[model samples]
Target: MNDFDALQAVIRRLAAERQAEQRACEAFLNALYHALRTASGPGLPLNNVTFDFTPDPAERLRPPPPGGWHAAWLRLGLCEVLVRVRRDEGAFVGEYGEGGTFHLTGVTEDDLILLARRLLRDVAAAYGGGGLVGRSGMPLN
Candidate 1:
């Protein structure tokens, strides 16, 4: 197989091996969500979480780029129901060639669910028709 195909095969294998870990992570996020809901005194689920993608975000928005940064926007919410007040918990990102990984930085389950829901929506929309969206925060130096 070509290098790209071989790399994809390896990635798929690694992903399969990590399935259990991903499930556990999801469970942990769910627990956190329940606790937040309990403390909040009742709630269904927050659909407020959003994914803002741009070829490049404002210099202020990006963390230091590692491993040849790729154009992609990502936001992981774990208790972001509070928006600018609390903060999204499980957010992370990476380049497309690098295999985007959703790093759950262990935020409240509520935030995780909210963030996941939004991401799922974004994924669906991306494949539905529109090619990957691109935007620029500031022109690359």
Candidate 2:
């Protein structure tokens, strides 16, 4: 094959690999979003919860690292949570409000769901109570 043909082949292969990685990331995020939403109970202060794809500087698309392209942001209330899924190493790393961080090795979806639940519960307890005041200096509940 000529040089041009060789380059075209390489580009096609890279595109396919990137697409696969994107699909995997989407699947993981979907499962996680469902877990979080289910865990949020009635009267919970958590609102505007959103998840989006975020790429880490240390990550690459092809030959995915131990912690691959599965990085996402989970935003709720006044907090932004980082969720990094490391499928190759069977682990996950999370960083969030107030310097709180957790690294779970040999992790499972259940573990992640539990962590998210706990974090939201804590935030509600701390900020959603009536002890605090809103911008107008009125009681907040």
Best by TM-score: 2
lDDT tens per residue, model 2, 85-116: 54434444544433344566633667757766
Q: Against the true structure, whose lDDT is highest?
A: 2
What TM-score, to 2 decimals, does candidate 2 have? 0.50
> CA lDDT of each candidate?
0.37, 0.59
TM-scores of the candidates in the order shown? 0.30, 0.50
| Candidate 2 to native Cα RMSD, angstroms | 9.2
- lDDT of candidate model 2 versus the reference: 0.59
Structure candidate 1, residue pairs in collision: 32-109, 33-109, 33-110, 55-135, 77-111, 78-89, 78-111, 78-112, 79-111
RMSD of each: 13.7, 9.2
Give the residue spans of candidate 2 off by over 4 A. 1-11, 41-46, 60-67, 89-112, 118-141
Global lDDT of model 1: 0.37
Worst 10 residues of 1 by lDDT: 79-88
